[model samples]
Structure formats: C-alpha cells, structure tokens
Target: MLRRAGLPIGPAEILAGAEALSRIELGDRQQAQAALRATLVHRREHFEVFDQAFALFWRAPSAPGEAEAGEVELLDKAPAAARRVSEALGGGASPAPPKVEARPDMALTVSAGEQLRKMDFEAMGAGEIAEAKREIRRLALPLAARPTRRFRPNAAGRRTDLRATLKESLRQGGEVLDIRRSERVVRPPPLVAICDISGSMARYAQILLHFLHAVSNDRDRVSTFLFGTRLTNITRQLRHRDAEVAFEMVSHIVPDWSGGTRIGEALDRFNRDWSRRVLGQGAVVLLITDGLERGGPEELARLAAATDRLRHSCRRLIWLNPLLRYAGFQPKSQGVRTMLPLVHEHRPVHNIESLRSLVETLSAPQSRARMPS
Candidate 1:
C-alpha cells in the first residue's frame, strides 16, 4: 500500500514494517498505526497520505458484489491515490471491485496524448490537428512580469511613502506614528504576434493561431496581427470566446490568406501605422515567418528597416521559424540574412514541445535572452 501510494518505501522498509506489525497488537489501532508509520514513512509531509492509506487498508468489506471496502472508502476521499493503485494493480479490475460503467467521454488515453506532444504540426492530419487544438487549450502561457514606474503601498517597503502617510494621518487626528512604504508595481508586458500566412506557412499558421488564441484568452494585453500579401490586425477578431468563430471571422477579414509573400510591404505597413499603438511599454514581439521574401533588394531593404524599428520598440523580439527545424538550413536568402541580426532569440515553432520551450524561455528574466551572432 505504501509503495502503491508513491511513498519511498523499499523492500527493507517493507520487511521492517512487517516486523513492527508482528510485534504490535493488531487489536490496538493506535499502536499499530504508530509502529507502521514509524517503520514505513520517512518524511514529515507524507504523514497525511500515509494515514489515509492506513485507514483504507483497515476498512471492512461493505457488501457482496460491491467494490472492496478499502477502495470504496478511498474512492471519494483520496481519489488520486485510489486511481493510481487501481492502475498499478492489473487494469484497475482485480483489487477494486466492479462498479457502474465508466463514462467513455472521460477516458483520456495517456500514450496518445504523449505522442501528440512531440508530433510536428505541419505533418498532423485532420483528427490529429483537432486533438492538438484540445491539447493547446490545456496549455498555460506564463509571461515574465516586469516592474512598472507606478507604485503601490507595501508594508515591508524600505522607502517611505509620504503621500500615503499623510492620507492615513488624517484618520488619526493628523498625527502619524507609523510611516507607510511603497513599492513599484509589477505587470506583464504586452505580447504582439506578427505571423506570416503565406502559402508555405499556411499549415503552421493554422496551428500557431490556435496557440495565439489560447495565449490571448489566457492573459490581458495580447495583440495578434497576420500578414500574407498585406498586413491585417485580427486582434479583435481573435478575442472571441469560440476559436472556430474567431478563425471564421478572421478568414473573412483577411483577404490574402494563403497567397503570395510580400514580407517587406506588410512589415512596412505595420511599422508605419500599428507600431506605436501596441509596441509601447516594453512589449515582447513574436515574429513567425519563414524569411521567404518575394520582392527584390528594394523590398529586402524595406524589410530590414521595418525589422530594425520593431527590434528597437520591444524589450525582446523572438523570431520563430519552422524552417529552422531543417538540419541543413542555411541563411542564403537576402531576407534571412537581413533578419538574422535583428532578433533577440531565434527558435523553431514546429511542434508542441518547441512551443512549451518558448514559454519557459519567455518566463525567464529578460537578460537571459541573448541575440544570436
């Protein structure tokens, strides 16, 4: 029971527990409990879990054709442990007696979910993409909170807050015995995602947009913009509660969905019109593209200028390219060379595991994200 409960009890501890049980009177629950706990448990925090297992182990059978009394006692109280024990003991059928049929909808296959985590988004089929969307919904995106110029009252703050002290003094006959302190307020910076929806990036974009939608609803101050032949701000459309409805509205709003790539022009439009509105307050920008510019040197020059402006406006700019997953990838194109020096971090966004790694990188301190040489 201790091993099944995930306690660190070895064979030696098991034999020791058995010896203690043999020495103690089985009729005395208190002495037996103490002896078993002393022999089996090694940590203070695990005492409660051990106590639960002990009580369940001693329970009597309730009736015929029902679950074992031990399992019945734990099914409602310590469900996670009970479920773990059931799985460990032969398909959860032998030790724990049978009950009503389990709901088919609640059955989550563990191996299938694990496989999806490492599967590449571009290679996923229709059903796999649907399952990946469900998995994406369960993911949590945590941003690194930055300290702001604004201050809030803090009792443990070192600096004196004269304004707060004066306000509090008014209630105490204008005589202040305690001086209040204040600390700078901290908040998550805005997240701006500039995604490429060109033909080559269509499959990756669909999956990434789902991820963006999840991040958008997970926190405040998130803006999303999609670019193909032209730039379109679908931040408002993506704010819808329903993902399907949001994507449907986005399709109608964005005229160029899986069209030609005009990276320079789209970026130029964003820098000229939308940069100031969303790129303030040390924003973090996620640039999702394959670095495949269609136009000539003039367009590449424009893209370089726009990317420079974007880098200057944000605290950290991460470039996520699915092409980076290629083992023989080289920055041979003018567009790729121009973008290489501008981003703080360059990473692959080809799978769920990569996305999770991105989340971890973003949660770290800003100083940790270094510009690639």
Candidate 2:
C-alpha cells in the first residue's frame, strides 16, 4: 500500500515496521498506527496517502481471524483513493482486456480535488475545507462596470458635443466641419456584503468568509460586513494579504461571533448607519443569511423597513442562503416569507461551485434577477 501510494518502502522498512508493532501494546489503534507510521513513513508529504491506507486496512474486527475475513470485505468497500491504490498495486479485481484502440489512462480518470469541488461545505472535513480556502483565494471577482452620467471625449460617440466641436473647429483654422463626441464614464458598482455569523451559520460562515476575503482584495469598492447579534465591518481586516492574520484580526474584533441571530437589529443598524455611506453610486448588495430572524413584536416591522431601504439603495439585492441548497427547502419561516418578495434575487451559497456561479452572475447584468415593484 505504501509503495502504491508513491512512497519508498523496502524490505528493511517492512522488517522495522514489524519490529515497532511488536514493541507496542497493540490494544490501542492509535498507538499501533503511530508505531507503524514512525517505522514506515520517512517523509512528511506522504502522510495523507499513509493515513488513507491505514484507515482502509485497519477498519476491521479486533479479533485476529475475524479481521482477516473483514479485510477482504474492506477491499471491496474501499473508497476511491484506496481503490486507486489497490489497482496500482495489482491487488484489485482483474482488469478487462484492452480494446483494439483504447484511450490513454489520463483521458478516463478524475482527480480527488475535482470531486471535492462539488462537495457541500457543511459536509467537508478540516483538510478539505483548508484546500477549499486555497481554491477560493484563486477566484477572480470582476463585476460588470456600469455607465455613469460623467462624460469623456470619444471620437466615435453617438452624441455630439457642440462646445468641443467649436473648439476643435477653431484649432482647425475656423473650418466648421469637424465634430467632437463624448461618452459616459463606466465604472464597476460598489459591492456590499452583509454576512450572517450567528451560531447556526458558524460552519459555513468561516468558509464563505474566505470567499469574501478573496473578493475584498481582488477588486475596488468591495465592502464586507459580518453580523451575529451586531454588525461589524471587516472589509479593512480582510484586505490583509495574509488570510490567517486577517481572520485572526476579525476574530478579535467581532465580539458577537457565534452568538444569537438578530437579523432585524443588524439590518436596522446597517440602514441607520452604514447604508448611505457604502450603498452609493448604484451598489450591489449580497445578504448572506438563512432568513431565520429572532422573535419579537418589533422584529418583523424592523426587518421590513430595513430590507425595503436596502433594496431601494442598491441596483441589485441578492440573498445567498445556505439553506436553499436543500431540494425541499421552502419559505416557511416568517423571516423567509418576508424576505422572499423583497430581494432582487435568491441563490444558494453552500459550496465552491455555487460561489463560482455567483462570480459569473455578478460579471453579467442582473437581467434574470427578479426585481420587486
């Protein structure tokens, strides 16, 4: 298994591994694994392959004879990585006869990393999440630029500038023939993201925050706000080149991290204080929350007012709810019902693929986004 995983293991290493196993109590699986790894694995980079192999090989009954029987079943039920290793080692089922004109091995197989892209964020382990973060950082978020009332000189513009035409004619020895044109200036709209960091959204928030951090640094006019029981602007912190340091700084700054969800209060605060400051010049707003508002007599009223203001302030308002990933999800909660008709768009944000879709959507005009009357 070690050799198949591209590790260098010889007869001497095998003997040493046996000797190390004999020295251990063998009663504890962790102790046995440590002994074997210490004896057989010489390089740190091979740890991932070794761990997968160890899990597949050791997942059996504790009893000796029963374990041998279990090993055969384990091989049959082995995961994709273990299956590849088994096939490489020639221990798997016999291969089919080659076709007359067979395609190369490279044409047929998909890498594990490709498979990870489709996996849900909530389902990923720690290692996969770390890998996903690296992938997120590589994403390019280029928003489509919109035309402004401000103008710049353009030789081929449709609209004629009478003053510029007269000035140009004066430069041309008073020949009243040449015409000057101007075009409206184009610039990307400001992007403001209000993300939920409450207890229910804890797992997905950290991963999505990495995406936001990448977006913040990739372009200008991008603002990021995290809300748990309160709203905290992390745009400056996320601008740091180092993701770890940026997240660390955010952890220190956000006092309400993993606290209760008070969506109404957070949005009210945003509308009251931050909205006018950031949501100017036709901004795009991404509200990342599950639409699960805290209960109170004033909660719905406050949320309604805030959402209405937010919608009116932005050119497009997109709500990214992780709960929408489920096939059977419905707008059952009062908060969800209230939000459904307010936003320009509602989309899922539970995986890397979804984020990629978001980037693509942002780059294009929001023609498909359902705008409220």
Candidate 3:
C-alpha cells in the first residue's frame, strides 16, 4: 500500500530490515526497540520499511507492552512519508479527496479540477504524468444530454398568458394557476484534435496523447489525428481503457512515428478525407504543432489554406504551439506565419496549464471574426 502510495522502498527491503531487527539482542524490550530503530534509521531508504516492519514486529499478538504512541503516529502518517518521497523525486502526491460542496450538482463540480489542469508539463516527468493521469481519472465527467429548462406557474410575472390560463380554468371550473419557465442548455460541441508528431514535436507528443486519451474516453464525438510525413488517424486506438495499451496500439498503427513533417500534405488529406466526416455538428479543431513545415512556403501555404477551409467548416479552430512557451517567441518562420493567421485562437501547448486553457477555449462560444486572409 505504501509503495502504491508512492513510497520508494520495495518488499525485499522490508524483509531484509525485518530480518536484521530479528537478530538484534538487548536486555530489555525498550532497549531492543531502540536497537531496532537505530538499525533501521541507518539508511534513508530503510526509514519507510522500518516504520512498517517495526510496527508489525513490536506489536505482534503476544508482544509485551502496547506499541509506542510515536510508532503508531508514524504508521498513521505513512501517507505523509510517501508524499515526502514523492516531492523529493519531483512528483506530486495523489490529490486530496475533494471537499464536498452543497449545491444542485455537487457531484459534477470538481474543486481540484483547475489545479490539475494548471500543472506544468516541462517540470513534470513520467511519474508526475502518471499521477496527473490518475487525477484526470478521478475528475472525469460523464457525457450527459444538455440541460432543459423547467416551467412552473407563478402569480407575479411579466408577459402573462391570461387567455390560455382562463381557457383551461373554464374547462375545470375556475382554479388559480401559476407558471415559471427557463431556457434549455446547449449541448457540448464535438472535439477534434490534430496533433503534430514530427521530429520537432516528438518530445511532447506522447504526453499530450495521454491527455487526449483522457478526453477521448470521457467525452463522445472526440476525434484524434497525428501528422508527420502523412496523416494518421488515432481515434480508434485511443478508445481502449488502459492508457499504456492505447499508446502501444497507436504506435503500432502509425507507421511514420517520428520523421519528416509534411504539414501541407497531411492537412490536404484531412481537408479532403476527414473534414466533412468529423468536422460536422460544429466540432472544434485543436491544431497542435510547432508550425514547422519541411516543404517550403508553397506547401506550407497550401497546408494553411486547407486549415483555413477546415476552420470555416468547424465551430472553432485553435492552434496550440509549443514555441509560444518561449518568452522570446516570434512568428519568424514561414510556416508559423502562414499557420498563425488561419487559426481562430492561437495559444501555447507546452504544459498542463496551457492544456487547461485549451479546454476553457473549447468550452467558450465561437468568435465571428474570420482568420486573417
């Protein structure tokens, strides 16, 4: 349980520590306990295992006195110990259980959702990503139909329908009536993600894919694609429950894993083949790339034109570029300049905070201004 909680020790170390404690000799029980504690604390790695082992050994069924309160406190605080290890290793602890708030949709509201989304991707490595995945799972929302307004009769209000109410009263021998009404909620839009898997984007692609998997499984009408030399559809592979399995499946299906980027060719394919199919129902397209096109400005221009067409077809087009993370970033590259003018929202996609921002952008209403022509 401790290991699962993110402790560094394994079972072998625990057993070894136990054996070492068993061999200790001392006159009194207190003295024996002191000796065992000293042996266990000799190395930092043994601290956690020793705490558990010492508790089990000294507090055995037939053992003399009750286990020391300090030992009990230490055992009780195992989670804190695990957290320290996690911090030292540069990974965050599992989020605390969400505080329950009294509201109409209490279950739907996640308090830690914003914090989880704001995590920095560059500072976080594999372990932090793993933890973030768990947090995403915990806060995952189920797909539900849009909310509809309820109507009830009220005594005081503007725009009264007295004629209709009177007609009903005439048929029922005159009874007082009241009414209330509210508008229905709009349904969530479909999500379309276009991730760049070219050599320049390789470093952040896999981690972003993990986030995409979480979104894909949690929502309906989610589409994912990877582009390099060619466009590869990865929506089917990401449907699996296990992230590791899903990524492995994606690897098998996408032949051009990390190679030359042909953004123009890939966008051309998506425009011709996928735009009508997946871009229907006012879907939002998340274009994730560094805007580095290998083929010169002509191909890049063609790709940007195709993307502009896609932008017109979809409800919204968001361009997520890792290059935006740099303070000195400028649209100096031909590809960046061409692609920038075509997207509705240009944002950074380097870390967790940026990803959270992407989600917020998706949820917002679409803007009316056209992409720069």
Candidate 4:
C-alpha cells in the first residue's frame, strides 16, 4: 500500500512493519499505526501519502462497502485504495459487492490533483504516469505573439502603404482612391526543443515527449529532437494526430534510445546540421538535459563552444534541467558549469508545476526572460 502510494517502501521495511505489528496490540490502532509508520516511512515528503493510504486501507467501512471515509474528506482516493485493500486482504474477490458504483469517471479530489501536479516525474507510479500523460497532452503552449520586420496588409493599420496604394491606383488611371495600409507581422516565435534521452533521464524523457507531441500538433514551426549519444529529429513523427502511432514511429527511427550521455557531441551535430535550418526568425530554444557530460575537460570545452553558438543563433536559450529540483543546487558538474552562463534562463522541469511556469514564461513578453550572464 505504501509503495503504491509513491513511498520508498521495500521488503525489508515490510518485514520490519510486520514485526512491529506482532509486538503491538492489534486492538489498539494507534500503537500499530505508529509502529508501522516508524518502520515503513523513509522520507519527510512521503509522510502525508503514507498517512492517507494507511487510513484509507485500514479504517473500518463507513457504509456497507468500505468506500466512505472515516473522518477525512479524501473521498475519491478512498474508492481506489479501498478496492486495492480488498484485493490485498480478501484475495482476488471482495467479501461483499460494493453497492456504490464509485463511478469510473469520478475525478480525483482537488487536493490529490494538486499533489500530482507537484509530484516529481521520477517518483510517480505507473498509474500516476498514465494520469500525467493525459494531463501533459492537454497542456497549451500559447506563446506571446511578437512583431516582426515583415509587413502585412490591413485595412485599419496605422502605417500607410505608398507602394500598395500606387499599385492599386494604377488600375484607376493613376487616380487617388482608397488608401492602403500595412501592419507589422505579429506571430508566435518558432520553438525548437533539444531533449536528452539518456538512461538517467529516461523517466522524464517519456513524459516530456508527450508534451512535445502536443506542442508539435498545436502550433506551427515547432521542432523536436531527442539526444542520447546521437541526435534524432522526431518533429515530423510527432505531427501525427494519434500519439501512440507517432511514438512507435519515433522509436523505430531513433537509434540511441537510452544510452550513454554525449551532450556536447549531440549539440555539436545539431549546430552543424539543424541549427541554421530551425533557429531562424526569433526562435525560442528549449535545451532539456541534466548537463552530465561523459567525457573529460576537452568535451566540456566543446559543449561550451556549441552552447555559445546556439545562444547567439536563437532569441532565447532556456536550459531546463531536472537536477535543478534538488535543494541547494550548484553548478558543480563540468557540463553544468560550461553551459550555465550561456543560457538566457535556467529552470527546473521535473514536475508539471514547473512546466506550467515554462508555459507562462513562454507566453510573457520577450523582455520578461532574464539572462544568466
């Protein structure tokens, strides 16, 4: 129950918990709960989850089917936990059929939903990962439109188009008729995502790819490339409306799915081949990696050079590092030190909340993004 709730519980902890239960009086729930928690719980952050799961799994039934809560307002979570408890305690079959259907569409309570938004991608269970995928697909990456040097025809624009006016008047025997106007082209900037798919980043990579797929289908001029030891452009593959088909296609084409990290080599390849092609017209670049270079100082120098060039080419070079979620984080790694001073913004991307912050930053004005150096 604790493991399913995202706690780092293991067989040893389970054995210790069973021994504690043996020593405690089973009739006194308080002693049993405390002893079990003392053995089972590992981290401070997982305490609330343990408490909720314990209460839901062990409390006596409020109604006929053990679905209702004893005192807590954790209604929706109770049903699933109750069902899991029933399976764990009553074998595969329930002691009595649940009278309440516990509607399949019953949405998670506000607290549980918020907890999921704040949960780390690495700590989530399989069920939470599926739920996170559905949430990621629905995210809207609406960038703030910026004006370009190019002009477009508009009836009520402030700028008068003398050339267009003359061209129009030529058809009327060169006589002045209605005035032609023009407006500066306002458009969403291009988005180019360079994501790491190394073994260390495997958990975050899968979820982020779903987000990239959504962005690819939602907007124009969005490019996605995955990198481990090599860089693979999966932008075209993600254009398919069906996500599963698109992912399968990406899997077939990308040679290095979960391999060693060669951050510099991959970025150098991208700079040589794809940068000029995609980083035009005020492009916003998202460099998603943990900045863990595999090679020595020479490789770090190459990463720095490639990153500096990339900074010059793109309008905004934002670094999204999952390692930034750690408390008291520092640029101790060679790769992190090489690239930190070059990026326009450094942000964490380990949870949905951080992604929401990214979406907001992308939608704000250009001046809102801060430069690191």
Index of the highest-lDDT prediction: 4
> Alpha carbon lDDT of residue 357, candidate 3?
63
The true-structure Cα RMSD of candidate 1 reads 23.7
**Tens-digit lDDT track of model 1 for 1-373:** 5554445465567799899999989999999999989987765545666776666555555653344655677667755555544443433343554665865554554566678888777545444667788877777778878887889889998779999899999999999978999888889999999999876787688888899998888899999999999899999988998999999899888877666788888888988999899987789999999999977889989999988888888888899999887878889878889988988888988988888888888887776356553
- Name every residue pair that clashes in candidate 2: none
* lDDT (Cα) of model 2: 0.80
Q: List lDDT for all candidates, in order.
A: 0.80, 0.80, 0.67, 0.82
lDDT of 1: 0.80
Candidate 2 stretches greater than 4 Å from native: 1-110, 162-180, 368-373
TM-score of each: 0.67, 0.67, 0.56, 0.71
Best by TM-score: 4
Candidate 4 versus the native: TM-score?
0.71
Across 1-373, the per-residue lDDT of candidate 4 in tens digits comes to: 5544444454667899999999989999889888988888754544555666677666665563554434235534454443333333332433574677566544644677798899888766546777998998999999988788899999999999999999999999999898999999988989999999876776588889999999999999999999999899999999999999999899889877655789999999999999989988899999999998979989988999999999899999999999989988989988888889888899999999999999998888786357542
Candidate ranking under lDDT, highest first, comes to: 4, 2, 1, 3
> Candidate 1 vs candidate 4: which has greater TM-score?
4
TM-score, cand. 1: 0.67
What lDDT is obtained when candidate 4 is compared to the true structure?
Answer: 0.82
Better of 2 and 4 by lDDT: 4
